[model samples]
Target chain A: MRVRTESILPYSLLAPTLIFITLLIVVPIFQAFLLAFQTADGEFTLTQFEKMIADTSFADALKFTFLLLIFIVPAQVVLALVMALLIHTRFKGHTFFLYIYALPLAISDLAAGIVWLAIFTERGFLNSGLFQLGLLERPFLFLSYQNLPALFSTLIIAESWRATAIVMVILLAGLQVIPRDYFEAADVFGANTLKRTLFVVLPLLRPSLQNALIIRTIFAFQTFAVVLALAGRVIPVLTGEAYNWYALNRNANIAAAYSTLVLIFTVIATVVYFRLLRTSTAEAGFD
Target chain B: MAGIQFQSIRKIFGKTLAANDVSLEIKDGEFMVLLGPSGCGKTTLLRCLAGLERVDGGRVLIGARDVTELAPRDRKIAMVFQSYAVFPHLTVFDNIAFGLQMQSRPRDEIKRRVEDGARLLELSDYLARYPAQLSGGQRQRVAVARAIVMQAAVLLMDEPLSNLDALLRLQMRAELKRLHQEIKATTIYVTHDQVEALSLGDRIAVMQNGRIVQCDAPMNIYDYPANKFVGGFIGTPPMNFLPGVVRVNEGKPIAAVGESHIAPSVALASALIEKNGQPILLGIRPENLALASAQHANTIRARVLVVEPLGSHKLLTVQVGAEISKVSVAPDQRVAPNDDVWLHFDPEKIRWMDAATGDAIHPG
Candidate 1:
C-alpha cells in the first residue's frame, strides 16, 4: 500500500500545474482557434481568415511588425549584453547602476511609450533642446507621416529602452554562474580583455542569449501598446489590428485570426531560435 | 627561463591586508612552493606575481623587467588554478592553443606546440575531447597543458592538485615533479598541504597571517622550523608543544616540562643558559619521540590515553600531566589505550621556543 501511494505521489503533486495550464493556456488557445475557424451561426469555415487576409491593413500590419522586430530585437540584445557585462564587472557603486538599469523594468509599456513620446513630440524636450542649441531653426516636426524613418526609429528606441532591461537581468543571472577562476586563468594565459570576452564569456553565455532571444522575439511580435501610445494610427501592428477588429469593428472572428497569426509567427520565431542557438552538452561541455 | 623576484610586495583587499610586505626571490628554473593555511595570502601573493592582483606597494621584477604595473597578459607567466579552469566550450586541443592563437602565432606553430604539450602530459588522445567528457585528473592535465603550451618562463600553480582524490593527488604530484625536471621552468606553487610542499619544492616558504614565517629547503624546514607555527603546521599529527622553563643544572641547561627535566643540545643549552629560569616551549616532533624502557635518561613517564595502529607505525597519544603528546611507535610494539609508558626525547632534537614570541631560540 505504501509503495503504491509513493508511485501515485509524483502525479498528485503535478496535478495542480497540469490543471492550471489546461484551463488557462490550453482552453483559451482552443477557444481562440474555434473562434478563428467558426462562422457566426456556428458552421465551420475559413471565411474569417480569408477576410482577415483580404483586409488592406493585414499586409501593412505584418510588414510593420517585422520591421519593429528587426530593429528592436537586435538593438535590445546588444544593449542588454553591454549592460549585463558592465554589471558583471562589479565596479564600485555598480549596485546603483543595476538599480538604475532595472528602473525601466518597473515601467509599463504604455508609460514607456508616453515617456518617449514626450521627447519625440514637436514641442517636446528633443526639439526644444535642438532649437535652444540652434541645431534646429524651430521645433521641427519629429513624429509625422512625412518622416517614416524618424517614426520607426522613435518606436525602436522606445521599445528597446523599455524591454532591454528584461534581457539584461537574464544575462546578468547567467554571468553570475560563471566561475571567477576561468577569467583568472585566462588572464594568466595572456588572454586580453576582448579575447577573454569572445572566447570565454560569450560562449558560456549562449544558453541565456537563446532564452532572451526567444522571449524578447515573442514579445516583439505582439508589440501593441507602445505603438498605440506613440505612433497612434500611423503604425499598423498585428495586435493593434486585432484590437481594432475586436473593439471598434466588433469582428471577433477576424480579431481571433489576427491573434492566431501573431501566435503562429511567435511559434516560428521560437523554432528558429531553438534551432539556431541550440547548445548540446557535447558542444557546451557542461550538463 | 627567467627568475622572479617579489620585493616587499603588499596587497590589501577592501578592509583586510591580504599580502603584507612579502619579499622573496626565486632563482631561474627553481621550484618554489608557498605553503600556508587558508586565507594566509599564499594565493594572493602568487596572483600579484601573475599581475592578477595589483600590489599596493613595492615592485615586482621578472628577469630584471619591472612588471609592477603591467597587466597579467603582459607578465609572460602562466598559472594553473585550483579548479583547473579549462574552457568547457573548447576541446582540449583548442584550450591549449588559445594562448598561442591570442599571441597571433602561426597556426602550424600553435598546433605543433599544443600537440607536444599534450603528448608530454599524456593527453594526446584526449585533445579532441571537451573538459566535461574527461575525468577530474584528465581535466586538470588539460589545464596544465594549457599553461605549459605557452612555454612561458614562469609557471604559477595555486593548489593545482588540491581538488583530486588522495591517491590521484599523490600520482599527480609525482607527475608535476617529473614535468618540472623536464622543462625546468621557474615555477611557484602554492598549497596548504605540507607534504606537497615538502616533496615538490626546492625551497618552501611557509606563510602565516599574510606573511612568510619561514623559507628553507624541504628537509631543513622539516628538521628545523623557525617558529612554533612552522613547527606545528609542517608535520602530520603536528609537533607537540609543551610549556616549560629553562633551568641551569650542573652547569648545563635543562628544560623542565611538566615535572620532567630533559637535557638540551650543547648549542641549545648555551642559548638557554642566558635565559635561565625563563618560560619556554619545548617543540617535539612525533617521529622524534621514541618509546623507552623504564628509567631512561631524558625520559618522561606517561599513561597511554589512546593508541592508533597504522600499518608501519602506531600513533600513541600519551598523557604527560595536563598535556597529551603524540608518539609514533613501531607497529609491533606492545601498546594499547590505558597502558603506562615511558617516552624519551633526544637532546639534539629538542628545540626551544620563546614562550611569549613563539620564535625558535637559536644558539649564538
Candidate 2:
C-alpha cells in the first residue's frame, strides 16, 4: 500500500507523452470516425458511405494506391538492400555513399515529389537531356495524362528513390551491428558469398528487416504528396482523393469516409507484414 | 591431415607491417601455437594461413596443394573464432551442421557428423538450445563443435578461450587439448596467454614485431628463448639476467658482476673461457637462485625488498647491486624486507646470452 517517490517518478515523466497522445492522436481518430458516420444535421447516416462507393474516381483511387504499393514497395526493399550491402562493404568511399543514400531521408515526401517532377515533367531536364544526347529526337511528354504507364512508372521511380533510403538506413544499422566474426566463420567453413548472406546475414538481420518492411508498408498505403505533385488529377490516389473531397468540393463527410478506407487498408497491410515477417523473441536480438 | 607452410608471407596494413616476411612450417597433426602480445601479427599470420587476408608477398601451401589463391572453403580448412560467432537465430544443431549443409552433404550424414561432434564436445544435450540461451563456455563448445564437425584437414583457432572467464578458460583449454588428441587435425591456435601456449602447443612460435622470434618445443622455448623479448614474454616471474664480464680469476673462468666474481655454469664456463674480458648476460630462472647461510665463493650479497608469501612458496624481491631480481624460495624460509642475504645460483640451470644482441650464446 506504500507508494515510493522513485517508483512514481518514471510515470510522472511519461505523463506528458501519454496526455499528448490521447489528445492529439487518439481523439482525432475518434473524431474522424464520428465525422465519417454522421450527417451535417447530426443524424447517424450511411449517406456518406454510399457516395464514397458510387464516386467513379473512388475506384481509380483504390486501384492507383494498390498499384503503387505493388510496384514501389518491393522495388524499394530490393534497392535498399543492395545499397545497404554496398555501403556495408566499406570499399573506399563507403562513407560518401552512406551520406548520399541517407540524404533523401532528410527531405520531406512533398519536396521529393517536386524534385522528381522537375526531372520527369514535359520539357523537363530528363527530356531536354535526352534530346541533347540524340537519344530522343524531340522532347517527350512522359508524364502527360495520355501516357498512363509512363506516368505510373515515373511516379514509381520518384517514390522508390525517396523512400528506399529509410529501409537502407535501417538495414545498414543492422548490417553494422552484425559482428565481422560471423562472416569470417562462414568463410572459414567454405560458404560462398550468396550462402553467407542467406544463412548468416539475412537470418541475423530479421528483426531490422521486419521493422523496415512494416514501416515502409504503412507509408506506402498512405502515399499522397508525390503522386499529387507529379500527375496532379491524372493519378487518382486514395489520399489525393480524400484531400480533393475535403478541400475542393468542401465535403468533409466523404473525405473522412475516404480516410477511413485508407486507415483500414493500412492497418490490414501492417498486420499482414507483422504476420509474414514475424521474429521470435530469441531471434529478435543477440544479447 | 594436412601440413601447412607459410613461405615468407608479408602482409602490410596501411603503414604498419602486420606480417613481415613470416615463414613457418607446421607439420601435419601438430598443434602449433602462435603466441605473442597484442598487435604482434600472430592473428594476422593465422589469417593469412586461413586465406582470409591476401598476402602481399610469398605463397601458402596446405598438404601438397598451393592454397594461396584458394578460398577458405576450397582450402579445406575450418576455424573457431574468438567470438564463437554461432548463428544467434539458429539452434545448436543447425549451427553445427551449417558448413556440411553448405557443402551439400546428405541429410543423414550431416546429422551423424553433427551428433558425433556434439558428443565429442559434450554439447549433445544443448543441441536444441539457441546460442543466446547458453552460457559463454557452452557457446565456445558450439564454435569448437562447428569447426571440428567439418572434418577438414586443417583447423585454425583465434584465441577461442579468450572471451571466457578465468575458470571457464582453464576448463575450455583442457577440452580443446582433449579434442585435438581425439581428432589429430593440423591446428594453428593463436593466443597471447603463455600458459595456454605452454600447456597446449606441440610447438610454440613466439612472435614479436610481425616476425617469429623463436619456434621450438614449449619447454625449449621456455628454457632457451631466442632473444630478450621471448625471455621476458614467457614465464611467470620471468628469467633474471645479470650483467657481467667474463674474467679469469686465479685460473678459474668467472663472471665479474661489478666487484664480485660469481662462478659460471660448466657449459657457460666453457663458452666464456675463450672470450675473456667480454661482456655477457647470465640468464637464470627465479627458482634456480637459493639463499646461502654464509658468504661463499659463488654467492652474491642481495638486499631483500619485499617478501610475498604465495601459498606453497615465497617470492622474494631482492636487489643485487644495480640489478633488481625475484627469487622464489620455500614458504618456511624466514626472510623479510631489508634483510641482507647471500644468494647462490645453480650452475647447471644457468643460461648464457650475448649482452648486446640478447641471442643465446650456445656452448661449443
Candidate 3:
C-alpha cells in the first residue's frame, strides 16, 4: 500500500501540467488534423486540401513567404553575429548598447510592424527628414510599391530588426563557455585574429549556431502579425491567409489544410537542419 | 638556442605589482624552475619570458636579441599551460603538426616531424584521437609533443604536472626530465612544489611576493637558505624556528630561549658576537635534531607531546622551554605521551636570523 501510494503521488504531482499541455497543445493539434480532411458538414473528404492547393492567393502567399525567408534568415544571422562580436569586445558603455540592441526583442511583432510603418510610411520620419534636407521633392512611398523586390526587402528589414536578438543571445552564451586559456594558447602560437576566430571560435560555437538556426527558421515560418500589420490586404503569408480562410471565409477545413502544410514544412526544415548539423559537428562533443 | 636574460623587469597591473624588478638569467640548454607559493609571480615571470605578458620597464634578451617588444611567436618560444591547452577539436596528429603547418613546412617534412614528436612522447597510438578523448596524462603529453615539434629556441611550462594524480605526476615529471635531457632545450618551468623544483630544475629561483628571494643550485638553496622565508619554504616538515636572544658566555656566544641556553658552534658564535647581544631567531631542521640517546653533543631536555612512526623514521614532537620542536629518530625508537626525552642538534647546522628583519645573519 505504501509503495502504491508513493507511485500514485508522483503522477498526481505531474497531473496538472500534463493535463494543461493536452488541453492547450495536443487537443488543438489533433483537432486541426481531423478538421483538414472534413467538409463543412463534417463529412470526410479530400476536397478542402485540393481547393487549398488550387487557390491562386494561396500560391502567391507561399511564394512571398519563401521570398521573405530567403532574405530575412541570412540578414538576421549576419546582423546577430556582428552584434554579438561587438558586445564580446567590451567597448565603453557596452551594457547600454546591449540593452539598446535587445530592445526589439521585447517588442511584439505587431508593435514592430507599427514602428517600421512610422519610418517607411509616406510623410514618415525618413522621408520627411530627406525632404527637409531638400534631398527629396516629396515624401517617398517606401512601402506602397507593387514590385516584389521592394516588398521582400522591407520584410527582411522588419524581421531582421525584430528577431536578431535571439541569435545574439545564443552566440553570446557559446562565447562565454569557451575557456580563456584557448585564446591565450592561440596568441602564443602566433595565430592572428582571423585564424583564432576560424579555427578556435567557430568550431566551439557550432552547437549554438545550429540551435539558433532551427529556432529562427521555425519562428520565420509562423510569422503572421507583422505581415498583416505591414502589408494588410495587399500581401499574404501562410499564417495570415489561414486566418482569413478560417475567420473571414468561415472555411475551417481549408484553414486546417494550410496549418497541416505549415507543420509539414516546419518538420522537414527542422529534420534537414538537424541531420546536416549532426554530420558537420559530430566531433564537437555537444550532445 | 640562446640564453634568456631579464634586466630589472617590472609588471604592474592597476595598483598591484604582479612582478617587480625581477632580474634573472636562464642559461642555454638549462632547465630552470621558478618555485614559489601561489601568487608569488612565478607564472607571471614565465608569461613575461614567453612574451605573453609585456613588461612595464625592462629589457628581455634572448641570446643577444632584445625581444622585449617582440610578439610571442616571433620570440621563437613555445609554452605548455597547466591545463595542457590542447586544441579540443583537433586530433593529436593535427595538434602536433600545427606549428609546422604555420611555418609552411613542406607536407612531407611536417608529417615527418609530427611523427617524430609522437614517437618521442609515445603518443603515436593516440594520434587519431581528439584531446577530449584522451586522459589527463595523455593530453598533457600531447601538449609536450606539440611544443617539441615547433623546435622553438625556448620552452616554457607553467605547472604542467599539477593537474595529474600523484602517480601520474611523478611519472610525467621523470618523462619531462628525460625529454629535456634529450632535447637540451632552454626551458623555464614554474611550479609551487618544492620537490618538483628540486628534482627537475638545474637551478631553482625561489620567489616571494613578486620578488626572487634566492636563485642558485637546488642544493645551495636548500642548505644555505638566504632568509627565514626560504628556510621555511624549501624543506619537507620545514626548518623549525625558535625565538631567542644571543649572549656572550665565557667569550662564546649562546642562544638563550626562555630559561635554556643552547651553545652555538664557533662559526655561528663569531657571527653572533659581531652583532653584540642582539635578539636573533635560530633555525634548525627536523632531521638535524636527534634523540638524546643517539646524540654526540648539544643536548637539551624536553617533554614528548606526540610520536608519529613513518616506517623508516619516527617524528617526535617535544616541548623545549616555551616552544615545541620536532625531532626525527629511527623508527625503532619508541616514546609515549608525557614522557621525558632529550633533543640534540649539530651545532654547525644552527642558523641565525635577525629577530626584527628575518634575514639570515651570514658568517663573514
For this target, which candidate reaches the highest TM-score against the unseen true structure?
1
Looking at model 3, residue B349 earns an lDDT score of 83
Please state the error at residue A225 of candidate 3 in Å. Answer: 2.9
| lDDT of each residue in A198-218, candidate 2, tens digit only | 888898888789888888888
lDDT (10s digit) by residue, model 3, range A15-90: 9999999999999999998899777687888888899989879888898778777877778877887788788877
Screening candidate 1 with a backbone cut-off below 3 angstroms (N, C-alpha, C), the clashing residue pairs are: none
Kept native contacts, fraction for each prediction: 0.68, 0.68, 0.41
DockQ of each: 0.59, 0.51, 0.40
Candidate 2 wrong stretches, greater than 4 Å: A1-51, A128-141, A282-287, B250-252, B273-279, B334-338
User: Ten consecutive residues with minimal summed lDDT in candidate 1 chain A?
Assistant: A278-287
Q: Which candidate model has the greater DockQ, 1 or 3?
A: 1
C-alpha root-mean-square deviation, each candidate: 2.1, 3.3, 3.1
How many clashes in candidate 1? 0
State which candidate, 1 or 2, has the greater DockQ. Answer: 1
The residue-by-residue lDDT of candidate 3 on B19-43, one tens digit each, is 9999999899999999999998999
Question: How would you encode candidate 1's per-residue C-alpha lDDT over B1-364 as one tens digit per residue?
Answer: 8999999988999888888999999999999999999999999999899988889998999998999999999989988989989888899999999889889999899999999999999999988888888999999999899999898999999999999999999999999999999999999999999999999999999998889999999999998999999999988988898888888987888888777888888777678889898999889898898888685778988899998998989988999888889999899988878877788998788778999999999996
Which prediction has more favorable lDDT, 1 or 3?
1
Tell me how candidate 1 scores on lDDT: 0.91
Ranking by lDDT: 1, 2, 3
- What tens-digit string does per-residue lDDT give for candidate 1 at A160-216? 888999999999998999999888877777778888888888988888999999999
DockQ of 1: 0.59
Query: Over the full model, what C-alpha lDDT does candidate 3 score relative to the true structure?
Result: 0.85
Which pairs, if any, clash in model 3?
none
lDDT of each: 0.91, 0.90, 0.85
